[model samples]
Target: MSLLKGKQLTHYYFNTSNYTKALENISLSVEEGAFISLLGPSGCGKTTLLSILAGIIEPTFGKVTLNEKNVTETQSEMGYMLQQDYLFPWKKIIDNVLIGPKIRKTLDNQTIEKAKQLLKDIGLSSVIDAYPSSLSGGMRQRVALARTLITDPSLLLLDEPFSALDFQTKLKLEDLVSALLKQYHKTSILVTHDIGEAIAMSDQIYVMNANPGRIHQQFEVPIELRQLSPFDARKHAKYQHLFDRIWEELNQLESTSIG
Candidate 1:
């Protein structure tokens, strides 16, 4: 069943003298516990669409529903992860993960224990008392992921959370994230410009077009590819074919824009 659905989503921006349409008739549905990716070039409204789904912004001409309820009314069940880890430099790793529950006034003894266990699960138990500056880029992102999971969100919105890491680190985190999402049974939507990342991680991919961004096509990753780790998935023969197909579609969109 669809855990989240957007119906004919359209969004616009208005200035004093001009109005711009950021998204046009974009529609998508994410199945429960499934991983989906929005793949597009910059300015394709991938992030915009994600923000709408998160209830950070309202669409001009559509509605977003999470489990048949409007997202705007049930925002607390969603978690958003961004490209930057955004951990405070002065805060200890454990403290950083506690920020959410603390802000919500729900950081009881049980919640604190759960946060510590999350750190342990993400391989950051030893660094619980260490500040963000003491950790490597990959470790910090892991802490960030722990923070996101601390809330027990049903819907996770990932906005290129691994983009800033090194390629090897990115691969490792991709494996970690995919595993954790499946383990937790969380429905996720990722926005990325990386083709291989999308193919390696997503169960489903929605290719988007720019200039009033809209869905161009949707592809389901082969079941065999989904069985392999993200790094190994790259070496699969079918991987290249899917990559080339998406590359061609994106190139065509670019050419049309230029012309």
Candidate 2:
């Protein structure tokens, strides 16, 4: 079943006397516990779509529904993880994880305990007291992930969360994130420019076209990719075939836009 749905999403930006359409009649549905990715070039409105779904931005002519209710009107049930870890330099790791509950005024003993348990579950128990500055990029992102999960969000919006990490670190975190999302049964939507990352992590990928961005095509990742770790998924025989297919589609979009 679809846990989240966007219908005829259209968004625009105004600058003094001129307006630009960032998204155009985009529509999508994310099944429960499924991982979905928005893949396209830099101007493809991927992040704009994500913000609209998160209720951070209102679409010019569409609506986002979560569980049949308008997401903008409902109480927040979404977690957003960005490209940067965004942890406060002065806050300890444990404290950072509790920020969500603290902001929502639900930071009680139970929430605190959950935060601690989440840190432990994410393999950061040994560094609970360490500050963000003391951790590696990957570790900080892990802490950020824990912070997002501590809130027990019904949906997750990931905007290139692993983009800043090293290639090796990105692969490791991809595996970790894929495992955690499945284990928690959280439906997630990731916005990424990396075709491989999208293929490895997503159950469905929406390839978008730029210049008034709209969905170009949709691809269902192979079932075998879902069973393998992200690194192993990269080596699967179908991986290259799928990658080349997406690459061609994206290239076509680019070439068409230029022409």
Candidate 3:
């Protein structure tokens, strides 16, 4: 079953000086429990498309749906994680994880315990009471992950959540997130510019084009690669082949755009 669907989405940004059509005729569907990635150049509106699907921005035309209902109507079923951890500096780690439930007035004894377990599951058990400032970059991102999962969102929108961390930390977090999402059977969409990250972490990848950003092509990771963790997937024999293919195409796309 498709957990989330976007149909012919188009979006525009306007100002007193000029208007830009950021996205055009974008249609996508995310199957239940599947992981997908949006890969493209800098100006391709990947974030814009993600925002539209998340209901953070309204499309100029068409619509998005989650579980066959309008996205706006089912907003609570989605969780969005951004490039930054964006945790409250003053709040303790536990309080940060519980913020969502607290904001929605759903926090209770059960919810609190669940948050604690989530933190422990992500290997942050020792710092439950520590402040965000005391944790390393990787650890803080882990806390952010627990926060997103506490509400048990059916679909997760990850917009370059690991981009800011060191390469080693990024790889570790990729493995951690991939395992947790699969364990919970959650559907996810990640927007990233790194082809390797997309191939390592996604079941399917949509390579996009700029100038009225749209999907230029799609690639499916082989079953052998999909079954492995992101780190191991990068070591597979077929990984380099696919990476070269995507690299060439992206270069061609860039040259075309520049011309």
Candidate 4:
């Protein structure tokens, strides 16, 4: 069974004053352990789609299922990483990472050990007691990732998590995230505006258009992570081809209206 499924999903802002058809007839299946990226223009329902899948919001007109069970109202185990790290400055690194487990009431000796292990895996064991401000932008994001992974979520939903980083840092973290996820065999979906980032970080790419926000095309990356970095992928011949195709798809939505 697919790990996550959205069936005939349609979301509309029903208001007599100002109604909005945010999403319509959207459907997709995410298999376990697949690295999928959603590429789209602004207001193309990309973020809305991620929000629904992460259980932050419910679809207005369809069903969302997780592991073959309906999960439209609540999510089971799912980790979400957003554009901002949202780390609390007052909390120490370890404390921040432990927040999820504490809130879930799953914090224990074993879980704490796992958290520490994850920090170590991410090369952050040295700063376990440091505050958020002490960390670099990339380091802060690493802590954010550790905090998310500490919960051992079955799926990861990344909503432009690397968009704010510098060109160099984004490339570095792309590799780091890909490696860590593969090591743990975690399934992930990344929502990004950068087609290069999508091609570099994903096995499958779903290109989206604006307005009603539907998939324009789905393509497979021809290169492997071991063969190219996010930045390096842009230099590959296939990247040129994919970029042109994706740009065309996005450009087609130029005349569409978004609420």
Best by lDDT: 3
Rank order (by TM-score, best first): 3, 2, 1, 4
- Clashing residue pairs in all predictions, respectively, total 0, 0, 0, 0
Candidate 3: TM-score?
0.99
Candidate 4 structure quality by residue, lDDT tens digits, 1-259: 6899988878877776887777888889999988899998778899998998887887888888888777654454889998989999999999999999999888899998998999999999999999999889999999999998999888999999999899898888988998889888899999999988888878889988766878777988775542565657767788788778777766766654422
Q: For model 3, what is the alpha-carbon lDDT of residue 233?
A: 96
TM-score of 2: 0.97
Task: Kindly report which residue stretches of model 3 are placed more than 4 angstroms away from their true locations once superposed.
Answer: none
lDDT against the true structure, per candidate, is: 0.93, 0.93, 0.94, 0.85
Candidate 4 global TM-score: 0.91
lDDT of 4: 0.85
Between which residue pairs do clashes occur in model 2? none
C-alpha TM-scores of all predictions: 0.97, 0.97, 0.99, 0.91
Off by over 4 Å in 1: none
Candidate 3 residue lDDT tens string, 185-232 = 999999999999999999999999998999999999888899999999
Ranking by lDDT: 3, 2, 1, 4
For candidate 1, write residues 154-176 as lDDT tens digits: 99999999999999999999999
Clashing pairs in 1: none
